[model samples]
Target: MKVGAIVTRIIRQMVRDKRSLALLLFAPLLILTLTWLVLDQESSDLKIATIDVPDSIITTLNDQQINVIDIDKPKSALKNSEIDAIIETAGNSLRITIDDSEPTNSQAIMMKIQQALVSKANVQQVEINHLYGLELSTTFDYVGPVLIGYFAFFFVFLVGGISFLREKSQGTMERLFATPIKSWEIVAGYIIGFGLFAIIQSFIVVLFAVYALGVPLEGSFWNVVLITLLLALAALTLGTLLSTFAKNEFQMMQFIPVVVVPQAFFSGLFNLENAPLWVEWIGNFMPMYYGAEALKEIMIKGNSIDAVVLEIAALIGFSLVFFVLNLGTLAGYRK
Candidate 1:
């Protein structure tokens, strides 16, 4: 009887919380819908170039599911990323030069090209070459940068957001307002204060993942740290800003599926270019998209600061926008 009564009371409380009940019923469906909408599309075209190739080889490539584009210069095309890869024939030798920016795409390109060459029943002349990273680099290396950003953002957003959310619950915000603290001071204080801890956390996570955990680290440690820190900042600001709209801690967590998880799906965790058009456009709005792209360029493509400057700029822009929005939102507390 006691156990039955406890269960009955729990059920009554759950029914009273309509948002929680709706979320329990609808969050999963919403996630499934967004997932199907984004992932239930055909892949985008993969462009390959054939240079000085025999007619038989060209015919074979054309028959495959890839796009064969004419390139005036194969070397320049591979270097410029104009083509995914190039299959070239010189005398009796056939060689492939792959643009290995995204390691997963590189693997797909190689497998398909190899199968095409083998189907001809003559592949003695076939050879493989990579434009960047090691030929032996694994999928882990390719996704290492993204995982780093996601993990850092994941932990910090929860801790920082929840810590602030507690202020509202414990009447800390009201207490603070009774003092002389300006609204902007409250906002800036939280940001700058958490920022110090976030930087340390970013350094530790990046170093641990790269050195201790054996993730691929082709870029300078400093560059990886820089990108991860910016990602953390974006997470911190975004989480804090969104926390204002959440009435309680549970609502704060609801942001995970709505805000964070969607970004993970669209942030190069899968092939961004392969998703539906509207879904791919969503990637442009995600802060994680730029961070993941920057990490890939730095770690796999071996790009420098200049090459990834645009992504860094986007991250900073996200941080600034969120910070300003927080200020505006907090103005409600003042007025």
Candidate 2:
């Protein structure tokens, strides 16, 4: 019950972990900067593509400094996310085909296109069509996919990270290393085993959100599950790998701000694209950014696997990188 002895031990432990001390002090600020840069930046002008309209329409949009692209296959482009909206004519009727995956953006695009058409000539009427999402869909529907992925990653990361940290702190890692199991085998087994639970968690969370909470599930539920499971794999592998850096559960929690929070900020939950050139490039490295995009495409856009193949590949790539890194890091615990 010596007070001095307890205080000295605490100070010694904190001093012993130089990396954890640095992470605790600076990681929050770094995450805050990224989040603020993304969430605080103003949105850019909408991207517009003209289909079979007149030269005057494209000229008007280009004149407005809007991102205007003249494309031959407007429908394919919109589906492929090549363009935000298309300006066309249907039997002399002016029609605007919008990629309505984001309702707010769709509204803005519609307003801009209307202004463009009005400025051109006498606008009698205009037809509006949605390539994906409903004009009536709420913000909840738009961000629901991100929420689902965030929650899935959040819980899985905590469980996976803490579980591995416990094994390390409790000396089970060294005991397992004492056996003949290769590092990759241990890593693979952890992924395959914990991945089963992660998949089930994804299913429950998605089902509850869509069916119980009435969040819009415009696309196939299976697609949502696929993207979500991939996201979980990335989180699981990342958590286990990062555990190599943490000495205990508190240090593992330290990763939450740096690893999890930044991803949520850029995961399309908030559209902060003003500093797009660099900030958007930063988001490319986050695993959840890809998952959120894929989920939005499937849950709201009703897009299939082909439409979001790039995002899927990104998530898979993240998982693979973290998986390999986990193996490499695990070698430190054993050989």
Which candidate has the top score in TM-score? 1
- Give candidate 2 regions above 4 Å deviation: 1-129, 133-135
> What are the lDDT figures for the candidates, one per model?
0.74, 0.75
Tens-digit lDDT track of model 1 for 74-193: 689788887788887878888788889866568778777876786787757455556762743345555667877876777667766766677778898887778766777776767775
| Residue-level error in angstroms, candidate 1, position 298 | 0.9
The all-Cα superposition gives candidate 2 an RMSD in Å to the true structure of 13.8
Clashing pairs in 1: none
Off by over 4 Å in 1: 1-124
Worst 10 residues of 2 by lDDT: 24-33
